[model samples]
Target: MKVLEAYDLVKVYRRRKVVDMVDLKVTEGKIVGLLGPNGAGKTT
Candidate 1:
């Protein structure tokens, strides 16, 4: 089973591309961690 999914997710800031065409998917009872450096769109 799929819990969360994102397709073609794009986020830009100040005319600059931040998250470009990102796709994600998560299954049931799955624990996923997002890790990234600062300014890496970790909170986007």
Candidate 2:
């Protein structure tokens, strides 16, 4: 089962894009983590 799904995710700040064209999927009972340094767009 899919717990979360996303497609074509885009995030922009000012004229620059923080995140672009990201596809993500999380199924049931799955563990997911975003690892990145500060300002690496991990939250974007």
Candidate 3:
């Protein structure tokens, strides 16, 4: 079963494309993490 799903996710800031065409899928009992440098939009 899919615990979470996303499609065509995009994020832009100040006319700059931070994230584009991102897709994600998480299964049950799965753990995921996103890590990046400062201002990389890891939490954006």
Among all candidates shown, the one with the greatest lDDT: 3
Model 2 lDDT per residue over 18-41, tens place:
778989999999999988678767
Provide the lowest-lDDT 10-residue window in model 3: 35-44
Once superposed on the true structure, which residue ranges of model 2 sit more than 4 Å away at CA?
A: none
Could you tell me the TM-score of candidate 1?
0.70
- Pairs with steric clashes in candidate 1: none
Q: How well does candidate 2 match the true structure in TM-score terms?
A: 0.74
Q: Which candidate ranks first by TM-score, i.e. highest?
A: 3
lDDT of 1 by residue, 1-44 (tens): 99999999998876778888989999999999988678877776
Q: Return the TM-score for each candidate structure.
A: 0.70, 0.74, 0.80
Which is better, 2 or 3, measured by TM-score?
3
Backbone atom clashes (below 3 Å) for every candidate: 0, 0, 0
Name the better of 1 and 3 by lDDT.
3
Q: How many clashes does the backbone of model 3 have?
A: 0
Weakest 10 consecutive residues of candidate 2 by summed lDDT = 35-44
